[model samples]
Target: MQVNINGIETRYVLSNEGGGPWLTFIHQLGGDLSVWDQLAGYFRNDYTVLRYDLRGHGKTALSREAFGMADLSHDLASLLDALGAPTTHVVGMSMGGMIAQQFALDHPSRVDTLTLANTFGGTRPESRALWEQRAASVREGGMASLVPSTMDRWLTPDFQHAHPEAVEPIREVFGHTLSEGYAMACEAVRDFDVRSKLGTIRCPTLTVAGRHDTGTPPADTQAIADAIEGARFELLDAAHLAPIEQSHRFAALLETFLERPV
Candidate 1:
């Protein structure tokens, strides 16, 4: 379904399931709501799962210029308000994780629990350099140039070799992405630094890390877990897209976490 959030037309798929708390899935950079398809079924039976394209992604309209993390967080807040979701358990991956952090900081009362997967709390020099390279490449060659590199980070060699079906959809997503939207997201990541403020997050938190992830290493997850008092940390033997590559384990962990008493 579509809703106007802060003047931008946002497209979201809301699961009609009732009786459980609402769960929101936020995808990584260059990704849309479809990225969560692999794990959505696991939650659909119990919870109201809301998956939507971030601003400037999928069917969501972009702003006139580039955006910051705060803007993205506000968009999320607007989405929750429009949906009349009093509170939600937010799960975010990579760049989405950064936005989730900011969202929790900005709208504490609206968030029930927070999960950060394959994400970073701040911009490290190495990551900054990589983002710069990707930004440059996207500007010059468009989104196609991002495919091979992104694929390498997203999936393990064995999984890639075994699942040929996954490649085409990923390629389609990459090919159809707007360079400007991606570049703007990269700039948001470049400027993001919330290390000092992570302690402000009061919601119960979980941090999931992909052991083989080069984009946001296990150390990043550890940092997030440590920063948030009593946050649970789990490491999966998968690449960056752990939710896709290890859907069962991811779903199980999330189910266990969300089902726990507050």
Candidate 2:
């Protein structure tokens, strides 16, 4: 389904449509709502699951103006209002994690629980330069140019070799991503810096890190957990895209967390 949000047409899917709490899933850079297919499928039978494509990515209308995290957060908040979802359990991965952090900060009343996976709170100067370079590259060569390196960064070599079928979907998603959207998201990531404000997050939070994820690294995720009071942190045996690379385990962890008392 599609909804007019913040003057952009946002594409989203709301599963298990019955009345109840909602589990909102946010995708990483170069990802669409379909990126949450496996996880959403796992949870929809037992809980309400909502997934959407951020502006400029997937089927969502691209924005002509450059956007930042604040814009993305407003987009999400507006979507929830449009759907009349009073409050939601938010789960975000990678770039989505950064946006989730901002959303929870901006609209604390609407967020029931916060789950951040395989994402960083901030980027170092060196990493910011890398982000800039990658953004420029995508703008010049399109999403295809980053696929080879991104695939390596996202999944383990063994997983890539053993589960070619699993990797193809991710590749297709990347291939379909709009270069302008990807580039703008990269800029948002480059400027991401919330380390000082993480302590203010009052919701129940879970931080999940991939043991083998080199992009964000365990340290980066740990810092996020450390900053958030009472936030639980766990490490998964996968790479960046743990929810995809180790879907069952990731789903189990998330399910258990969601079921915990408030």
Candidate 3:
């Protein structure tokens, strides 16, 4: 459940069912591995599902020195090495999607398929100030300050009213996030940009966008698919966290993509 990867105490779980190729899930910023609970459970039947907390979130420890997206990718690389997993199909949402792109570009050989959901090809210029403001606000008021806004952004109003239970876990994860870790990760995301380098990704890729997701618009997600040689883009009728809002549809889409990529 916990292992030291590149000196960071990373928390991760690998399912033993089927003993098939690994299907790894990476969560978004301010959240932990649990964000992929339903998705992981769905895929565990056929693929060896892996759900892990990023370096600065959940039970994982952050680095003392400065770091970047590449360092996070290195952490993932070391994690697979520790687990003795040769290759994995990576599915990432929001910030996790950025990490997947970085991993695919940096360590191409280790990734079998890349599925980026509700993510961006690069950090937009306007997003820098927003991220900085959030980092400052959380550092000052703690993680609770951002919960309301995050929930509103992640889920549409209709879904929140219809299914409060589904949103509770995400709220808990984001609210309980360590301020230091969240701020540290904020910097990583603030400085991340791989738009120009997206062409380097050689693995079969899938890009997903939430139709109502304002954080990463559908056009942005489509651009990512366009940049990659043969990536496909799909749009879902949900907000930022489409997988949770429409778990069955997302799972079915992913199942098809992994079974027979085009």
Top-TM-score structure, candidate number = 3
Where model 1 places Cα greater than 4 Å from the true spot, the runs are 125-129
Worst 10 residues of 3 by lDDT: 13-22
TM-score of each: 0.95, 0.97, 0.97
For model 2, how does the per-residue alpha-carbon lDDT over 34-87 read when each residue is reduced to its tens digit? Answer: 879988888887777899999889999998798889899999999999988889
lDDT of 2: 0.90
Question: Which of the predicted structures, 2 or 3, would earn the higher TM-score when compared with the native?
Answer: 3
| Candidate 3 Cα errors over 4 Å, as ranges | none
lDDT of each: 0.87, 0.90, 0.90
Model 2 clash pairs are none
What's every prediction's RMSD, in angstroms?
A: 1.5, 1.2, 1.0
lDDT for 171 in candidate 3 is: 94
Error of 3 at 22 (Å): 0.9
Report the Cα lDDT for residue 150, model 2. 91
Residues 127-181 of candidate 3 have per-residue lDDT tens digits of 8988888788888999988888889889999999999888888899898999988
Name the lDDT value of residue 213 in candidate 1.
99
